[model samples]
Each structure stands twice: as structure tokens, then as C-alpha cells.
Target: MKDRQLYQQILGITTPWFVAEVELDLEAEEVHVHLAHQQASWPCAECGKPCPLHDHQNERTWRHLDTCQYRTLLHAELPRTRCEEHGVRVVDIPWAESYGRFTALFERLVIDWLEAASQQAVADRMGLSWDEVHGIMQRAVKRGLKRREAEPIPYIGVDEKSFRKRHRYVTVVSDINRSRVLYVSEDRKQTSLDSFWGTLTEEQLDSIEGVAMDMWEPYIDSTKEHLPEADEKIVFDKFHVAKHLGDAVDKVRRQENKQLREDGDDRLVGTKYDWLKGRDKFNHKRWRAFCRLRRSNLKTSRAWAMREQAMKLWDYCYPGAAENHFRWWYRWATHSRLEPMIDKAKMLKSHLKNILTYLTHPITNALSESLNSKIEWVKYTARGFRNRDNFKTAIYFHCGGLGLLPAT
Candidate 1:
């Protein structure tokens, strides 16, 4: 077969478009295929009304799939149509999308490579710059966001993650049941979460059964302002609750350790993890060692016990039973003679109404936590992002579960 015929078949050229010429430059190790239009006029891209051809656009070049060992490029002249209502615009082509510098097939290849590797790694492997690869990602995310359907999400999670050091953070909203990121915005303030709520319709917002998050006042205020019946729908995450308790216990340990050191007692030194770790986390020998530590009359022991008892309150099936159990633990915690425990107990009690809502929702930000772990990996893989927009784009591209390919 002739070279033009071979390239035409490989490119899948159909009517109204064909491979007019093929040039192989061995010195540059590139294959250039020139395309031509077969008709004098075509239908308007916007309204589908037939119009006369206006003129040929300037020569355009697009990177195509490599032909063997040579880099393949396509040269084309986009035909313009003079539409009466929509005015003159370039007609759409079959092989590529409008304003794109790569064929649809080549973009698909880039998307796959991006999913398998980091953006920088994919750019290095594909002989493309970082901006070119990121542009594809930007377009893919735009397409995916446009295609997402507004369905009722039964359970959702909202959390904050740092984009960089020095306390910079972004709020992330996710569909817990679907296990995908729904929205992301700068900062973790009330307005940051409010923007996500603004994206949902009234019906969609009404369909939300529960939202799991930490007891951040801004998030609470935002939800209370936007969502109907927000009291019942807001479920404080159990893990965040545990974190609070753990910090209280650690504080107790630190103060007691300082006092004991004055008296030459060193038992609490380097035993922070022993109190923080779950009871069963230690092996049999370590468990026995910790048992001896627990037997001592240590103030940290009382604090740790109170935290453990509070964690068990989550096992009750009904809110009434859970509330009763929590009250029992709360009384013990408040009276534990540790200032930190008293402070934490008071804080948790203030939010007790929503904390017990966990019985009905039984949902937590565990999935959101899991997604955050993946996001951390993404950041590490990229060697950290200098641009905040690029950081957000990377999260959506990797964790949004977006269908990020152009339709051919």
C-alpha cells in the first residue's frame, strides 16, 4: 500500500477528511501526516444548519500516537463555516476536540499514563512538559465535573487537609457511600464548606441522611444554616472524639510526669505510647508489661480508663441506650480529678446531642480519613506542589473517580 493510504487507515479517516500527504523525517525521527477536507462546505457546528465554507484556518499541529520509533504528528487546516445565526466558527472534527493540541486517542493515552504514574513522571516518559500534561488533567476534570449527575447522597463526609506547611488548609467534601470527593475549596472556614452546599440542589441537600465531621464550629454553623434538620443529620466522627480524649490523657500524663520526676519517679517516662495504644495492640509480653504499669497508682491510668470507657459508649444500638451509657461515662470522666479530663468531658457534653446521633447514622469520617491518606500519597508522589490550584486539581484527578477521557 502507498504511504498515504497506510496512514489514512491507521488514523481511521472517514468521509469529509482524509490523509492528503505523509512525510517521514529520519533526521528528526518524526512522522508528519497532513490531512485535507474533502468538501467545499459543511453543516454549522452549533446549529447543524448547512453553510458555505468561509476559509481554511492556519496550519495546526497535534501530537499523535508514536508510529513505531518515530514521534507521530498530524498537520491540519481547520475549515471555518459561516453560520447565519451562530456566526462563523470552526467546524468540529472527528479525530480531535476543538482547541485541543492532541488527538483524542493521544489524550486518552496521556490520561492512562497519568493515572498509573505521577504527573511529572508521565510528562518525562511521554516527552511532554508538565504544563501540557496538567492541561489535559484540567480538561479531563472539567469534563468529569460536567458529566456528574446530581444524585442524593445518603452519607457524606467533610474534613480539612493542609495543602502546605504553616497551617494552610483546604476543606474536602466527599460522598462516603460512593467513596469519591465531591468538592474542594480553599481554607477550612464556614464559607469553604458552604460553597459545597451551594453546589447541591434543594432536593439533593434534602436527601442527605447524615454528614460526618469533626466538631468544628464553622462547619457546624454552615450546616445548620444551610441544611434542614441539621441537628439530626450532623454526626460527629468517633475517631475525632477519640483523638480529643487521647490528647486529654496525654496531657494528664505529661503533668504527672513532671511532678513525679521532682520526686525521682520515672515510670511514666517514655511510656506515652503505652497509654495511647489500644489495650489489645500490644503483644502478650508487652501486654503483661503494660498490665503492671496499669496496676500502679498513676493519674494517667485514670485518664486512660475514662477515655476507654467513653469509646465503648459507641456500641449501644439505640440513641437512648447510648445516651445513658455516655452519661455514666461522662459522670466518671468529669469526676476523674484530672483537669484535662474535666475540660474534655465538658466539651464533649456540649455536643452530646449530635454525638449520640451516631447511633442513628452509624457513619464516621473513616472513609474521608482513608481518602486523605491517599491524598497525602499524591502530594508526596508529586514531590509537593508549588501552586495551590495544581494541588486541588491533582486531588480531583486522582481521588475524584472522574471519567477523564474525551468522547471520540
Candidate 2:
């Protein structure tokens, strides 16, 4: 077969362009394919209007997919066009993306590998530098974000992830129903989320029905400032609420353990985990330790009971029943002589309406937590980023689910 025809078949060249020549350097271990345009007139890269050929630009080379063990390259001297409107500019190419030095096919492969591996791994496997791999991912994410669906997102989850020490954080706003990272900004402040809401259209803002988040005042304030029905929409996440309850129980355990130690009793020493163990989570060893505590009349034991019973508040099918149950539990906890538990009860009482919004929405920040875990893995695999922009890019590239692959 002719070299030109063979290259045309290999490179998927179509219409106004064809493989003009092919050169192979055995010593260099490279295949260079030259491309030529068949048409006499050149089209403007920006406007696509046919214009007179102004001049020939410098010959450019693009890295193509490797053929076997040898690197393949595409070389073309693109023509410039003098358009009446767009002025003199280089005409577009068929095989490579504009302003990119790599073929689209090569970039697509890089994107695919990026989904399964880190940028460093992909770079090492593909004989590219770390910056090159990062650039590929950044470009893919840009394309994906440009093409992202504009349909209304009703439910969302907002949270923050620390990318560096010293509380360097980014607020992530994610679609709860779609389970996709929709926006990321460089802080957990009200302005961080305000920036996200600022990008939304009035119709889009009005479409928001619920937002599940932790008890961060900034997030609550931002939602209230932007959303139409913030009171009915903001939902305090169940997991974060449970964490507060657990912290209160641990505080009670610490206090009681301190008193017992003063009384020369070492029974509660090294038993902190015992007080936090869930009712159904105890194994044989933890069960025995907890059983020992259950037999005692310790304040920690009473606090643990209150913590476990608070779990029942989420089980009620109706909002009114859950409200009544929570109120009764609140009264018992506040008067039980346990200051930490009483404080937690008061905190929950303050956010009681937002807590009950859970019954109406049934949405949680579970997906955001899962995404945070994946983001942590990304950070670990990459050994942490040197800056915030790189960290944000890594998170959006991996957890954003942006459908970055090019169309076949």
C-alpha cells in the first residue's frame, strides 16, 4: 500500500485533508506523517468564513498515539487566512485540538487513563511529564465544565475539604440527586458559597428546593441569603448531628473518668472507645467492656444511653411524632445533671427546625462525605498539592464526574 494511503487509514484523515507523506527514522524510533489540505481557499479559525491564503506559518508537530513501541508524530504547515472580518489567523486543523500540541486522540487516551489512575501514574506510564498530565486533565475538565448540563438542580450538599494544613480549605457544592460536584471555591466562608450562588441564574436559584450541610453558620447564612425558602430548605446532616451527640457522650465519659481517677479508681482508664461504641457495633471484646460499663451506675453509661436513644429520633415516620419525641428527650437530657449532654440538647433545640427539614427533604450529605473520602485518597496518592489551584483541579477532575471524555 502507498505510504500516504496507509497513514490516511492510520490517522483517520478525512475530506479537505490527506496524508501527503510519511517518514520513518529507525534510529530515532519515530514515525512522522505530513498532512496537506486539498482546498485552495482557507477558512478563518474563529469565524469559519472562506478567505484568501495570506501566507504559510511555521511547521507544527503534534504528538500522536504511539504506534507499537515507536512514537508517532503529525507534522503540518498550516496556512493563514486574511479574512475580511477576523484578520490574518492560522486556519484550524482536523486531527488536533486548537492551541494543543497533542492530537485529540492522544488527549482522549490520557483522559481515560486519568479516570483510573493519578496524573503522576498516567504521566509515568505514558512517558509524559507531571505538568503535561496535569495540563491534559485541566483541559479536559474545562471542556467538560463548558459542556455540563444546564438543567435545574433541585437538591444539593455543601461542605468543605482541607487541602493543606493550617486550615486551607475549599467549599464544595454538589448536586445531591445527581451526586456530582457542581462547584468548588477556595474557602468555607459565606463568600465562598456566595460566589457559587452568584453564578446561578435567577431561575436556577429559585429551582433549589433543599440543601443538606453541616451546622456551619456560613453555609446556613449563605443559603438563607440566596435561596427563596431557606427555612424550609436547609437540612442539618444526620451524620454531623450524630457526631455532636457522640462528642457530648465522650465529654461525659471524660468527666466521670476524671472523678473516678481522683477517687483512686482505674476502671475507666483506657475505656474511652467503649463509651462511643454503638449498640450493634460491639464485637466480643468491646461487648464485654461495654457490658462491664452497663452494670455500673456511671454517668458515662447514662450519657451513652441518651446518645443511643437520640438515634431513635430519626426512625419516626412522621415529623410531629419525631418532634414530640425530641422534645421529651430534650427535657430529660437538660435536667439530667450532665452539662455536655444538656449543651448538645440546647444546640439541637436551636437548630430543631432545620433538623426537622430532614423529614421533609430526606436528603443528606452522605454523597459529599463519600466524595471527601475520594478527595482524601486523591491527596494521598498525589502526596498533596503545592498550591490551592492544583488541589482544586485535582478534586474537580476526579470527583466532579464531569464526563470529560471526548465524543467518538
Best by lDDT: 1
User: What residue pairs clash in candidate 2, if any at all?
Assistant: none
Q: State the lDDT of candidate 1 residue by residue for 150-224, as single tens digits.
A: 899989999988877758888889999888899989999999998898899888998999999999999999999
The digit string of per-residue lDDT tens for model 2 on 1-408 reads 256897788788887888888888899999988888867788789888889889888899989998767889999888888999989998887787777878889999999898788778888999899888888888888988888867798899998877668588889899887777889899889999999988787888888899999999999998898888799999999888999999999998888889999999978889788777666777888788778876789888888889888878778888899999998999899999999999999999999999988888888888566777777787887663677888788888988888786553
Point out the worst 10-residue segment of candidate 2 by lDDT: 378-387
Model 1 CA deviation exceeding 4 Å by range = 368-370
**Cα shift from native, residue 111, model 1 (Å):** 0.6
* lDDT score, candidate 1: 0.89
* Each prediction's RMSD to truth: 1.5, 2.1
User: Candidate 2: global Cα-lDDT?
Assistant: 0.85
Candidate 2, position 17, lDDT = 83
